[model samples]
Target: MASNEVVVDGEVVHCIGCGAAVQTIDKNMIGYTPESALKKGLENGEVYCQRCFRLRHYNEIAPVSLSDDDFLKLLTKIASTDSLIVYVVDIFDVNGSMIPGLHRFVGDNPVLLVGNKLDVLPASLKKNKVKDWLRQRANAAGIRPIDVELISAKTNFDIDRLLDQIEKYRKGKDVYVVGVTNVGKSTLINSIVRQSTGIKELITTSRFPGTTLDRIDIPLDDGKLLVDTPGIIQPEQMAHHLVGKELKLVTPQKTIKPKVYQLNPEQTLFFGGVARFDYNSGDKKHGFTVYAENNLYIHRTKLVNADAFYASHVGNLLTPPSEENKTNFPPLEMHEFKTTRKSDVVIEGLGWVTVPADVVVSGWAPKGVSVLIRPAMI
Candidate 1:
């Protein structure tokens, strides 16, 4: 046994991954290390705990079963301390990425809004225009950030600029990075860590929610720290209803190749069972451009036969929330929107459909998912 090893009867050790107390029982719980693994780790003076082991070797993520009360308690700690809040958001799913009541928890700290996943947008889109649009949306949500930076953590885009901004705004205080689940907070932190400390894959990351269970701090050059906080699970995000593989189908891994579908009134488009769109009323054929995962299966049908098509094809043709997840899947709810001008009908966490001016369209998603309309982002 090592001199630093402190072994208690019940709680034995802390995981090197996310710094959670490790135990040998409860396979479903956080920081579960097998008894044999713990013994081996103690003998060799190398301990990774089970969660960190799986994340490093298999690239798998385990959900941190944290209650809302527990998560809010963690956020409340930030309010008492002086820190710079780095609020990261998914550029593709802006509405779904917002943390509710965040202003109350951040006190008067200046927040730097980081819009991630910028690589998922179309290449032709202007960067300045997108930044302006994000600023307006964040302001509307009652979040007034000191600066809004657009970056793609997956592609390493504009990371240097973000780091420079952090150095300038942090003013020797600790930086706390926070966001709702699946917003690339871990990915962004990992990138920053790799650049600053030459440490690769320090944190576990995946498309699923709750990969980070507790706060992990990385020391900065000036003795300040960059803290990564656990992501809050928003019930409205489609990621909550989806299985792991189903989530990958909805989350875009690369730049979306916009698929244009020309439709007349009474036509429908099904994005698997995740989302459905109907052109209920329109004067003529309008172009509907879909910005979603490149490999997601899309089917077209008559509006009248849409129900029957979904019923028969859900598990087979329209998969992802496949047959195994059918019981958990909620019945799709309908939301009708009349577009006075060009806009995007966004199915939060899935993707969006750009519709032309003067059209009546209806969007459907599983219950609890958010369906909203916003000015066209492209």
Candidate 2:
């Protein structure tokens, strides 16, 4: 439901949407509302911070603020509740987006994996292959989802199918949608509202039965609640390291165009200073297909000279530190992997580089962001 009136500090008002304190300043912070909107909501006996108002009316998303401890508390509350967990993740950044130890938090609730932004991948990438890979990754993360559905919220593709999967697995139980930010939860919510059958607005914000934690609920026709939880912010995502303009270069704003390169044993490919791929050892020339945002720069150079090259050219020749951020940019930490089989060296939020078998490579990213290898998807 839209507004759950909760009094805070005896005078301060809290948002019914995600139970955050509402403020009139700093749009980037959680629970921000313009004075006019707040007044109108009060006159109507309802109040929604701009984020919730936009989420409900326009299918738009805004940033939310939460520390790790609070997020863990929320997850703990979720574990004690009886609900079906709809775990959404970015198809592009599954490993980086997963909440560590999620399997332990949901208690007995079965999970449904929703992979959003399939359209961002190339048309040649097989959807079935991607689904299989996603399932494997989810398993590795200790979650055995009841099913996996890959869809593009931007295109409204497979939305009805997603709703059907939710209905099938929910078993007349309440549904809890959860994900880290930028995984397209808001868009998915919009699509579900447009497609799901027998939807009714939830009117009560009473703490979820046994806990003081509150969630925004939309009632399903069957009288079950479909709840929207606050998106947790993962500090390891690349977005936390770069400035706003630099973030655009890494984020897939449109369909990514594949770039393939032939590499030798000591060659390196720099994904703009955002990531580094060093081909430390490989016999003969092998093809490496890059799946990244079209605008991100990929530069190739001899591995021997890579340090000097990056040292001299990080901000300009290699970018995303831009000229202004180079000195303050977090140092990239390297993780090495040797593949016995064809694989994708995924640099989390930044896309992946598909490499041939029997090759040793090292991936580097902003200190906290992860770099790992997964069995090839395509």
Candidate 3:
């Protein structure tokens, strides 16, 4: 009856961190421990399913795939509970990271929006302005959180203040931290656990989506719990289309150094074939600054030869999608926008390009990925 025991055949044991059914088979599955390890855990009365074990010990994560229907079912559970919702989002990919219809799921519960990866933004960017932007975007999406806080889980920036804010708003009610995948929810929780309980790296944190399969509850001092939910996997995320190495090439691991490009009316830039930006009808000389992974390859080319260049150099000059995913990679779909004001052309899951006002630009990404223009976040 203890928390760690596996009551053989009577009931299935679940991972303490991810809440997946612990089994000794299928290493590829969500909650898998070897037979010997399972037996040892059963005898010792302490267990972390293999996924959590790797995540804890080796800082590695195994990807688990889930259907949208399954994710919706998980969200539906939160609606029936009287808990405070902490909605975490990636500041870099605001549109792609938002869970559509989240307001419906949380019911009357007050939501707190936590923008993760604030450290990725330019240091010159004002925090209050960023928070205001987040609030406006969240309101437009029907998520009017009681408070909006910004933090970088990777860098531990503003974490202490964020914890204080969460404590104030929670008011002894249970807290549910939810987000779409790759938003740093697990990393944020891991930081909180370390700070609050002195338990180092208690939860699995990874760049992959669905790292936390089911809800994992961490007990708070007030007898309430802070639950970490599985990241809702959005198909529109460019992370889904990329492999490990390819993903690394695109995902920012540290503060980005914005790359500035001087463009003419008919210039094009390719972000490794994953995303492309064409300055179709801009001024003869204008600037486009890209904020993305520091190492992501950016190649400039004439607009007329852009197609031929891409066809010839997809895996070489334009790197990731890396030959392995070339066949599966959807041809870039173009979406044109004429920016009346200074804006960022965001290719969901990839990064954004800040363009000067009154530029006619065409942003492209693989089919199904979102390409939109939004007020510049920088």
Write down the worst ten-residue block by lDDT for model 2: 203-212
Which 10-residue span in candidate 3 carries the lowest summed lDDT?
A: 1-10
Model 3 accuracy (lDDT, Cα): 0.85
Residue 98, candidate 1: C-alpha displacement in angstroms: 0.8
Model 2, position 19, has a per-residue lDDT of: 56
Of the candidates shown, which would achieve the greatest lDDT relative to the real structure? 1
**Model 2 Cα lDDT, one tens digit per residue, 1-378:** 224333444666766555566777778776678889888877775777777676556655454455667766776778887889999898877866798888667888999999998889988889889889889888987889889999997788998888888888888999988887667775677567656643322221110111112356777898888887766667787766776478778888788888889998999999998899988997888999999989998999999999999999999999988999888888989999999999999999899999988999999998988898888877
Residue 256 in model 3: shift from native, Å?
1.0
TM-scores of all predicted structures: 0.93, 0.83, 0.92
Question: What is the lDDT for 272 in model 1?
Answer: 86
Q: Which one wins by lDDT: 1 or 3?
A: 1
TM-score comparison, 1 vs 2, better candidate: 1
Candidate 1 lDDT over residue span 102-143, tens digit each:
987898899999999999888978999888988998898999
TM-score of 2: 0.83
lDDT of each: 0.85, 0.78, 0.85
Candidate 1, position 59, lDDT: 70
Best of the two (2, 3) by lDDT: 3
lDDT of model 1 at position 103? 85
lDDT of 3 by residue, 1-378 (tens): 434334576976877667777776578766778888888877876567888888777767676655677777887889888889999999888887899889777888999999999887788779999899889989999888899999998888989999999989988899999999888898899899888878766676766667778788888998999999888888888888887578889888888899899999999999987889999996569989998889998999999999999999997779898887888888889999998899999887778899989889999998988998888877
